[model samples]
Target: MKSPINLEVVHKVIDVFRAQYKNRDLAAKTEKILFNLAATGHRVSEQNFRAIVGHIRNHDMMSPWFIVSNVNTGYWITKDEKELSAYLDQELNRMSNQFDNVSNLHKRLRHGKTKGTGNQASLF
Candidate 1:
């Protein structure tokens, strides 16, 4: 698994979003963290900060997977079978990894120059 992003980068991205949105809540969080770091007199680099914030924003803004629902007689109802099936198909296509790994392994084997071992023990 990839390593978690550095705290300094996370703080930088939060700072930029707070600046852009002028959100007091977000700004407050950023300020609290940044101020604590400053109190210790440790400075994080701007470039590293920007990159981390960029990654955070990119990840944060992703749309959720959803299927539409309807209400009838003051009751919430599940989506129609057709709509549900379509949504399932789309989500399955998006999440499927069978082809991706298979093709990569095929390409690697095709390009590899290694020959079979001549000894019977090697085959075993």
Candidate 2:
């Protein structure tokens, strides 16, 4: 079976994300959009993918593609499919950590205690 992720393809998707979102925080949104596009069974070109990845990487976005492909050819470096799966698993784990951190921060800010306590704290 072929790998689901190709560096070339990831590059293209990144390009599309940059063009469409134009913001660093657009990763999750871009992922959803790209997933929808991909689910439609449409194929994207390598050059376009490379351009996209380049744009995102240039802007310092966290790209999960680099974990799979070589820096030069945007091609897969691993011959084993299991290795590729493992790489993706690691990336997802990293993303989950980041998400947890952000979620905790947001939760803290939302529930932050104000100056006045007792009755106000109870109300909150």
Candidate 3:
């Protein structure tokens, strides 16, 4: 059986995440959080740390406290509802664009296959 994630580590990470709201200089990246935990002799695996963060984000813990992540900015905690709503909008737009791109790619692949122009046809 897989071992449970350490509750102590989860709380520690939450504390560190909350501190980022106060200290803008402190980055809430995965590496930074891991480093902070290590400094206090709390050794947590990166996988475990990510899992904990995902849970916290999923449950929307500490209402009005939003943990938003973006490709450019990584992860960040915000108390402003406006900021959180904007982030949600941005993510939705990004995912929509990605879905369109993927659909177009699939159409192109199908067109090529119908034309017998697929590059790896003989490899089968």
Q: Name the lDDT value of residue 122 in candidate 2.
A: 34
Deviation of model 1 at 58, angstroms: 1.2
Candidate 2, backbone clash total? 3
Clashes of 3: 0
Provide the clashing-pair count of each candidate structure.
Answer: 1, 3, 0
Candidate with the greatest lDDT versus the true structure: 3
**Pairs that collide, model 1:** 13-53
Q: After superposing candidate 2 on the true structure, give the runs of residues whose Cα lies further than 4 Å from its correct spot.
A: 1-51, 54-75, 112-124
Instruction: Residues 3-105, candidate 1: write the lDDT tens digits.
Output: 5567664554344333433322222333444444455564545444435544653565312311121222111112246654654576576556655546555
Candidate 2, 1-124: lDDT as tens digits: 5334455656555455445443323333333554544764546454444455555455545433332442222333232457567656866888888776676555565565664543323322
Q: What is the lDDT of every predicted structure here?
A: 0.41, 0.48, 0.70
TM-scores, in order shown?
Answer: 0.25, 0.31, 0.64
Rank ordering of all candidates by lDDT, starting from the highest = 3, 2, 1
TM-score pick, better of 2 and 3: 3
* Distance from true location, Cα of 67 in model 2, Å: 7.2
Task: Return the lDDT, model 2, position 117.
Answer: 43
